[model samples]
Target: MSSVDICEKHRQQSTKTSFISFAFPYSHLRPCAHRCKQYVVGRSYLLQLQPKNRRNSHFSYSCEACQTEARSTSTENNISTHALSFTERLWKTYTNTATLLTNLFPLWTLLVAVLALRRPTTFTWLSTPYFTFTLSILMLSMGITLSPRDFKRIWKRPGIVILQFCSCYFLVPFLAYVLGRLFKLPSDILAGLVLVGSVNGGQASNLCTYIAKGNVALSVIMTTATTLGAIVMTPLLSKFVLGTVVQVDALGIAWSTIQVVLIPIALGMALNRYFKSFVDIILPISPVVGVIATCLVVGSAVAQCNKLILSAGISLQIPIFLLHLIGGICGYFLPYLLGYNEVVCRTVAIETAMKSSAFGFVLACLHFTAYRVRVPCAISVVWMSLVGSGLAVFWRYKPVQNLKGFRSDLAQRLRQKRQLDEMK
Candidate 1:
């Protein structure tokens, strides 16, 4: 099909009969320009390049025969080379369609929340049991996506993880407390806001990080760290902040956190490690499943608080919106100020801005249901998704430039010291 094959065939025909005639078209001309007399095929030459130093610069010529043979062999390795069975092909199609749907989660969440506000009855049915199940699926999706290498990234960069952990557990919660008080939100709503901040980074953080072209592995690791830490941190912090307002059950909160976040994720990771083949089949649809679960969770919470939302003034919305807005702004700035790379900064920003609202809702339902606290958690979910998605889209186009700062300076100094020590 290629010039190489054509010339090879022509050379073989000539060897069996006579020389290649000049009347033959240029398309079938031999690669070796020097082999015109009797058209005896020249030995395959070494690779030739015009400007060898510049990879982008074109001009490569080769006729090793090995190259052609290697390419043909690689073709067989491609899926297209083999006959796929009907089910195999059908499954591939389903996964592909699911993946396409998954990318529309932001739009889908916004739409479902709006719908739930109108018809509470429709979504309210996805109640307590559904909430737990959906949240588990969301976390499970995150779990299966991960590998041991993802956890290794945590150890590879513990400092960044620490910063993220502190930001998630400390900075955001403090901001929520201050914002709630500053806005003079209702006591129950204040408790809800605090609960929102106190919980771990949402599974959605990983998706947002990926959209922003951030360090996804680092995001996943930070997510895992924050989530595991949340079991202890969330209950204690929520109690500390809301003790005066309500009876905070620290142990119940801790157990619920373990049930919702820890167990499902651990089970997912175990499946990934031990049963990779099964994981692979389901991996494509994992995000889609998470998105569906998230939408259902969002819809249910919004539906439950439908009357509250309809009657509630702008006073209720401002603090929750501001919570994510300010958290996202500061989340990005803190890491950038510390001179972390743009990707890491983006990852931390998303993780800080987006708390596990579904998890928060479940907790509020379990413990603070009497206080009508879950309403704020529902509201927080909608707002944070919008805020984080907006940031991801905005930063996708905006490039980070000349990021010279403390981190870079520190690296430089370390390199210099190492060089001096070597010289000595």
Candidate 2:
């Protein structure tokens, strides 16, 4: 039997013994009187009481106090155990399914798009209002997960957080713009790529940094700061880069950013603060909502792939996608070489590389009719999930080599231990 069953059995036995002891007065009970009489007659009949009878008698017996106690304990145990098991199962399912989907989603989206090319009308449903709603829901879920503690930590370590955000908002976007210009990508795709690069770090960056044993607080702050900055930066950079190719209104893009990004986050923060108990109650199930929203968004993007491929063409997408992958790698590691610690480096790298493609895609749909504008963002979404997850796993299990600085820290810790031992 499972440990739970074993524990339940023991609990029931204990409860039965307690109830039996409480129910009968030992001095006045017939069994006790007879046992005493037998003892006086120099016989041991007490041992001859049937064990089966003792066990069965307790089950048939019920006392008001004992019953109440037993019922309360059982109910509490059942609820706690059930809740724990459900959480464990949900986490297992999310990680496993996310890994699977991340690996296969891009290829699946591309293949389905190619197959459905001849019957374009079949996939037309991807452009419906439901798809946009799913995107909005995904953003809301992401916003709720952003802890305020992240910002507090940034106040403590402003330099590191600022450096990380600079890498994300300034360095990465400029690199992507330069690469896009050099490659001479099509107008819509180039605008999309620049927009993707111009946006802030994704929500997944915090998850990745946490897994990597990095400064997750810094990552969260950087994400929040950069996201706020994106309201102005994304539109301005997009206009500058895509001005010759296509018209983009910077003020309009800023308003869209405020509508989609700022409003939801502010509302979520307020709700979380004012209804802290309610948020705590729902926090366990928040991941479920996030996973469902993510799936819907991906499915919507995939369903729109035919239009994207038709308008942008495979050749343009292939090179730009490759460029994006390379840019992400460069963005991730550059901070490390610039004297930041591994944790800061990992955070910066992830933040710089992983764009908030959901934001980009939503903005694209709002601003442009061309489905091709979402192609780079869609592809990046899948690519970064796969790459970021792998990096997270790697850092989680990666052996810690005692470099000079780490060894010095370890030495200081050992010295403190020795001093404490001496004091003891």
Candidates in order, TM-scores: namely: 0.76, 0.66
Cα lDDT computed for each candidate against the true fold = 0.79, 0.63
Candidate 1 global TM-score: 0.76
Model 2 ranges with Cα > 4 A deviation: 1-129, 146-149, 310-314, 369-371, 394-397, 402-424
Q: Which candidate number has the best lDDT?
A: 1
The residue pairs found clashing in candidate 2 are 332-349
**Which tens-of-lDDT digit does each residue in 1-424 have in candidate 2?**
1222222323344434444334333432332122222211101222233555643332212233444676898899999999999999998897677565444443553444444455655545656466666655655665666667756776887776777667666776677677777887767877777777778777767767776677776777888888878877888877777565677777777888887778878777776778778777666565556555555565555456656656656665555555455655675556545545566666666666667776777777777666577777766666656566666667779754423334465677999999999999
TM-score of candidate 2 on Cα atoms, chains taken together: 0.66
Q: Model 1 clash tally? A: 0
